[model samples]
Target: MRLLSRPLPAALTIGLVAELLFCWRLTTPHMLVFDEVHYVPAARMLRDLAGPVNIEHPLLGKTLIALGMLIFGDGPLGWRALSTVAATGVVVGVHAMLWQIFRRVRTANIGAVLALLNFTVFIQARIAMLDGFMAAFVVGGLAMLLWAMRSEGGAVWRRWLGGAVLLGLAIGTKWTALPYLGMAGAAFLLVRRRHPDLWPGLPALAGLALLGGAAAATYFATFWPAFLYADQPLTLARLLPFQIDMYHQQTQVLPPHTYQSNWWTWPFDWRPVWYLYEPADGAQRGILMLGNPVVMWGGLVAVIACLIAWARGRDARAGGIALLWIASVAMWALIPKSLGFYYYYYLSSIWLALVIAAAFDHWRDRLRYWDEAFLAASAVLFIHFYPILSAAALRGPQSFHGWMWLKSWI
Candidate 1:
């Protein structure tokens, strides 16, 4: 219990720092950038007139964006304010999740710092996107699941039900979040088997039903806005067709994008997607949604090390992180689509950070200050990539060229 509560300040501190980093000069690119063009207007329509827009995705994220716009008067900062808040929650959630699973304050703190140093987390936090909201909810759900696993029978359902609600919200934000729900279900069954006393008379099937039912109910509730705003009367017959249309729209192939890289290329940082690039006379700006190489590549290595630890010594923490990373990565690979972006690796990257943290916890006893050194190096890399990550104007073409490690990144 102390371990759970002790990290509250650490989580808040990480979140506060992330908000500052993300919110600094938040209105620089005064207009819509990248996917903001798609979702922000939808948000505006929703907030202004309760109209349906971007029906392919769920409404909660856009609703949050709409709420921000309504409260803040629809500036660049207004559009992104909720994203910034969600990103901060993600940082805080990562700290809580890591501490819950690993029970090491230093390891948890390191994972949270690693998250801030991660370019995708930092950049996605600043932009108006569903991915940030999904990431925050995913982390929060995972943390809640861990808390449930640690609880007695009396509190287990409440904790697990809370986790299910968050995961459902995650799914409502993006369908990609569905895999995490599956993972949570499997984990719940495991907890039931291993800790039968914790479940009392509840069977695993009944427990899973309760969890999944809660998630399904929450997801169905998130569609209320769409139902209310549709031209036709609200009915399952009407909604089913719209859902089918959305699915078809998503899966259909489109023209090639310059930064469209496969899931395999993400961990390698092969091609960084340029979300925004402007070459105006006095206002050259760019935002490349790529992971920091030091952290990304190093996280890949940590995944391997964690796998080795799991294979050789049956390290549960190591194994859990490695399995989670593999599952997250594999989920993208299994997506039956011709197009995917580097940011598709966002969920996997969070698990990789956990792998790095678990390995750090192991190595801290044997190798002194290596964890600290890694964090320091990661911070330096974040600084080096800030210009491109934050869309800051370059002094010249050469200033931009200096940061491009590969021609694909250009």
Candidate 2:
């Protein structure tokens, strides 16, 4: 029988297997990590509110978390399931985006592999947080937007609309997604300005309108608490004020958190927040936080390579996308936000992966040997750090040493 004739490739199969195993391991020590205490509570309150509490963040991620709570009963698995699924979606989205960009199966597979092996993506996915979901939606939206750009058909409007809606969802997931949307808008204007014949202004305007409208409606709908309070004619006036108060609450720096650090320290991978644990139970207690060091450090080289390639115009598409990612990641540095952590570097990882994948794609033909060597090295490093990064069992000093790489990390 040819039923299994076209089985999945080794790389894809391995990646999927790793993701599943990691998910299982991650779910093991499922206590609320980091800001999850805030998000999970907010999600619980969402059901009770007539309007949203006006938290600085949009509601898509919280909504999904709520869904998981509904299904899984608000346990660690229930709260984190959504994040895991979203992380998986990010892997798929990266693959789909690469496929659209390179128009080759191998390129897409490579991109997906790199993303799966990414420490930030892996660590963030297993927790009950909004970053993974935001990354997924933003990357997914980018994939759709790229497809729309490449497509040449009468139904292109549908593709454009899909991209816009996804972009809106991305914003709903995280405010950080706004920069990507702006980039998309800028890219559209540049592309349209250059070739007016290919992309008309009307469609672009319509697409933006649809995106903005959908996003606004979704945002308001998620604020159930605000609406309920606004039900009374007199209380309606206080609705906006209530929302403003919530925003203030999110931005306000309360007491000091052990993990809190300045944005400047993030890029160096300093101050990673401990998200989950089951105590040191001799060994095999399982830890569930921290990104892989190999991928994070190696990305530095890839970032440099991408800059050179983009500067030389050798891989303009790859360069442009990398720049977009960098711009988004750099926003944290530019902002005046008081509280920051290593995980905030998630967007930076996305940029790094794109650049790395682009470099690999560009040099695959010219430097096959180097590509193979780098891939092997990356794999080994990821494996080496897997136990510590994922919080698997380790002896006393070894476990402590794992986190002692930098003074700031401690």
lDDT of each: 0.82, 0.67
Per-residue lDDT over 185-231 for candidate 2, one digit per residue giving the tens place of the 0 to 100 score: 87777766665654333466766676567655654554443354333
lDDT of 2: 0.67
Model 1 reaches what TM-score against the true structure? 0.94
TM-scores of the candidates are 0.94, 0.84
Lowest summed lDDT over 10 consecutive residues: which window, candidate 1? 226-235
C-alpha RMSD by candidate, in order: 2.5, 4.0
Q: Which candidate achieves the best TM-score against the true structure?
A: 1
